[model samples]
Target: MSLQDKNIAMLYYGEQPHPAHTGFADAIGADFICCNPRSDGSKIDSPLNEFFNGFSLPDYDIYITEGSRPLYSGIAATIFSDSNLIYLGGDHRLRELSLGGFPNQAQTDTRYLRTRSKILQFLCQHFIDGAIAVSADSATFLQQLFGSPSTVRTAKPYVQRDVFKSLSTLSTDLESKKVAVIASANRGNVGDYKGIDMLVDSWPDVRNHFPDLKLEIVGKGHQAKHENTEGVRVKGYVEDLDTVFESIGLYVQPSRLEVFGVSVIESMVAGVPPLVTETTGASSELKGIEPALVVDPNPESIASGIVQYFDRTVAERENIAKECREYAMSFSPDVRTKIFHEEFKSLIDEIQ
Candidate 1:
């Protein structure tokens, strides 16, 4: 059952493969393919399988899918029919798991369909042979959901450390006063779970402490109203995070709910300190890292964290920034791939 030379497949949404799953694929070597079921018969590059949905599935030794059934629907039954299947509920979908009676939440949210949740709940509860956790917190949650907390594997989020590190440079004085937040629109919208609104609400207080403070929100669909707000700028949908991280001194991750925060790690490697919340799974690894700030997701606490950076003199800030760069070196892509590869190998070894 060792993953060496074993065929592995991962199911995901969208035309391109997701970065998170890419890490898993890299761990398993080139034999692992990213399966995109919704392709329109168009040509896709290698390592991405577009025809696996309706056609005969390749004889994969291992198969993995996200916790949601949205991608494959009834096709899941076919994929799970033979291979060693694993469910990954690591997207921090507590509400979805709650609906499934995972015991993480006492009651399901009325906003979601109880009948659908019940059906999927039964599938997750009984079908998958194993599970992969993105973090320790995710492992615990999966244990409850999979009914096998003692057996799930834990791996932290992956960081493209070298790319970001190469883009990182010492910022000029003006750039030092700038702060940035990088998250998808769905995740970082003002009032949504990402706490973008909490950061925006706290901006006035941050400005009160340091009037020259400038904050930039980089992601899709940032509201036009917020564009006019003083000392705040919104840039929608930047394809590359390297450009955003290059000039900013700090990255803020104030999410109300998150299994893992990749951008935070990306920023860290780009020579920026991150202000995160314990609510994020990445916090377990980021809590004590140099110059890292952890606080509640509320506006007051987030504002306080923002102000703390200003509290330090320029020289002190520069010193910590150097330390942060060094800290970022530990989580490079190769290191992460090696760690997960061994973890996956261990899992395969344990399997009968």
Candidate 2:
């Protein structure tokens, strides 16, 4: 179908410089629009605002909705107004909203019933066909909120090709003192869920094991305190992550829970070994890959995993790196886009 004839409009917070969000928009053949609140002097209001102000979608069948918090509010309103199907992607935070003062069974029932009534009203008004959530956890949350499990479908998170290409050139030299990277964010922020504090608390033990090991910390908010440690460096908010990935020997993601560990996949594609938590979404995909080390969030496990990599022979390390890179290629954006296209088409047909 032609872009106009397809009748799809993707409502997201805004296009990040990161490839995944923009890449998904390109793949869907939909009119992508930002619903984020415009901040004074912020560049976020530049091109997207200009485009959305003048743009209109005449014939889109779906609205691929993404983003967190207030942006979600705007997208929800749009969905209600349009009577269209919405595919919820990214982190699903709606399940966390509190239904205040609903203590008694009667009050609780009334609260939930009211919420569902509004949702159903919106769905009927907008002609919502269905919704596909990126994670099973997210789908479960939606089902709980809506009291209709049939309305929500679950899908695994996919990697974008551009991110793969960016990661593809990363060096896999284990002998080098290339530190694994973690970007800290504000508490209760998106990155907070990434478990930066877990890594921070483990830093001292990690440093004691490998004195020469360096940590490349990026992004803003509470910087990790490595006061007595020499190797830990905070490189705040780097724009060129490709360069950072190139110099890094490994990427570490110590999250307690993750819907999809895109960073791990990116690290594998970059030929950098990933030391990740077993609880992460990427762990399932990295099963049998030698370079991708799955470890507990504890400092001892993280240190041991690093030591094992260092202890390996150059040839063995290279072999592991090759395996990682090969594994990462299977999740490339093009492959994922095709899968999404086919799955979405099938869902549409099934509903029709």
Q: Provide C-alpha RMSD values for all models, in order.
A: 5.2, 6.9
Q: Candidate 1, clashing residue pairs?
A: 143-149, 219-237
Quote the positional error of residue 64 for candidate 2 in Å.
Answer: 2.2
| Each candidate's clash count | 2, 9
lDDT of 1 by residue, 21-130 (tens): 67767677634333543355554343223334524555666666654432343144344465566655556554444644322235645556566656655666565566
How well is each residue in 189-308 modelled by candidate 2, as lDDT tens digits?
335456666665666676676677777665665444643356666676666667767777667887655656677777778777788766555666566775338887555666677767
lDDT of each: 0.66, 0.59
- Angstrom error of the Cα, residue 3, model 2: value is 8.2
**What lDDT does candidate 1 reach at residue 195?**
69
TM-score of model 2 vs. true structure: 0.70
Q: How many times do residue backbones clash in model 1? A: 2
Alpha carbon deviation, residue 351, candidate 1 (Å): 3.4
TM-score of 1: 0.79
